[model samples]
Target: MFELRHVSKRHGAIIALDAIDLSIAAGQTTALIGPSGAGKSSILRMLIGLEWPDAGEVRFDGVPLRRETLLEQRRRIGYVIQEGGLFPHLTGASNAALLARTLGWETSRIEARLRELAELCQLPFAALSRYPAELSGGQRQRVGLIRALMLDPAVLLLDEPLGALDPIVRHDLQTQMRELFALLNKTVVLVTHDVAEAVWLGDTLVLLRAGKILQKGGIDELLDVPADPFVHQFMNAQRRLREDA
Candidate 1:
């Protein structure tokens, strides 16, 4: 549903992304993985129209990304970033209903949707009245996810959404996230440095490095036929690492 064609972005002499081309299909999850400075976040930024490419184009459903249609297109996609990014003062329900309020949804409709989302995300009804400061890291992340999914966007972009949680909470959220995505059938593009996370959440994986794509394919394809030694090593290490005790 989204396509990036030969896109490149630069900051003076530094290249943030280099000739990157990617496509995210409907009702599928694609993960972007690599070391830091690999242009993973840059790709998300471009997709969300937060950053424009210096060359080439980013298109959503065949339409070139434009300022006029950006808000409409964005409303059709959900995004969650690292650290939850919730307003410190807004209650969880308020946060989740932000978009709905903007769209002129009635107070009752917003309340009902908030309740439904809380249930879907396995959060307590009481959480609706709590602020970010009152919740644990995991709770905050779940609230963030619910906020993004409130409008039931066709596409979801998650940029290291689980990074700030504790290990156990992270693992639990990972499973919950997978189940939620499958149930919703949303087109998902997730950015994570963790190779295991990429494999677990993505039907297809793209390994990036130095602002360029190193390889992209299904999990089995990449594991069985790595593009180079770097990919081979990455896959092997991920396979061998044991869960933290």
Candidate 2:
């Protein structure tokens, strides 16, 4: 499990994150939803050790995050971002196997892992030979996901993973992602602005605003019993739209 205890971050005079406290369970998918500059990405970054907190600590499996343990912790966490974060010059297979090679995994083992992840992600075998430029947006994102999962990380952090794809592709990838996460049983933290996406993909939804947690719980819990007017309005808008449709 991942725990954030009174975690706060500041940049000069700007407070990027307030005294935030949250717990993320293993093998569950949690979506962080909010408007822009709400610090959703900041949370993800802190988890991956990209950004250090000015106060408090981020703990994984009861161990506090520290420089001495950063590398090992990172190796156990997978991160995906917009644009897939693939190397344009490398083939999909090379990209996926990069970490394995760096970790001194055997050639045969790397190939086997690539094949397994490709199958699990439902990516075509042909895509392994293709460069990022030659693949579609969805395909690139799939490769990016495969790269992250290549090591079978315990936790996956996704920052707007579907933001760059077209609607059709986004929907398809979303479905695939949910199924993949379920099968893998890896803890997932997804950051997105799309309300519907959050509802669809998350086992639990965390709403944030201005570096603070507004609400966090199951979708049904929030919908049926909102904490305040903002949540009430947000839930009602979806409910009314669905009712009208």
Index of the highest-lDDT prediction: 2
Off by over 4 Å in 1: 241-245
User: By TM-score, who's the top model here?
Assistant: 1
Worst 10 residues of 2 by lDDT: 236-245
Residue range 70-127, candidate 1, lDDT tens digits: 9999998889987678999899888888889989999998888888888889999798
| Model 2 spans with C-alpha error above 4 angstroms | 237-245
Residue 221 lDDT, candidate 1, scale 0-100: 72
Alpha-carbon lDDT of model 2 = 0.88
Relative to the true structure, candidate 1 has a C-alpha RMSD (angstroms) of 2.1
Clashing pairs in 2: none
lDDT of 1: 0.87
Q: Superpose all Cα atoms of candidate 2 onto the true structure and report the RMSD in Å to 1 decimal.
A: 2.1
TM of each candidate vs. truth: 0.95, 0.95
Q: How would you encode candidate 2's per-residue C-alpha lDDT over 1-245 as one tens digit per residue?
A: 89999999987887778999999988899999877888899999999999989999999989999999899989998999997899989999999889889999999998888888889988997898999999999989989999999898999999999999999999899899988988888899999988788877888889887888888998777777778777777666664422321
**At residue 95, what lDDT does model 1 achieve?**
87
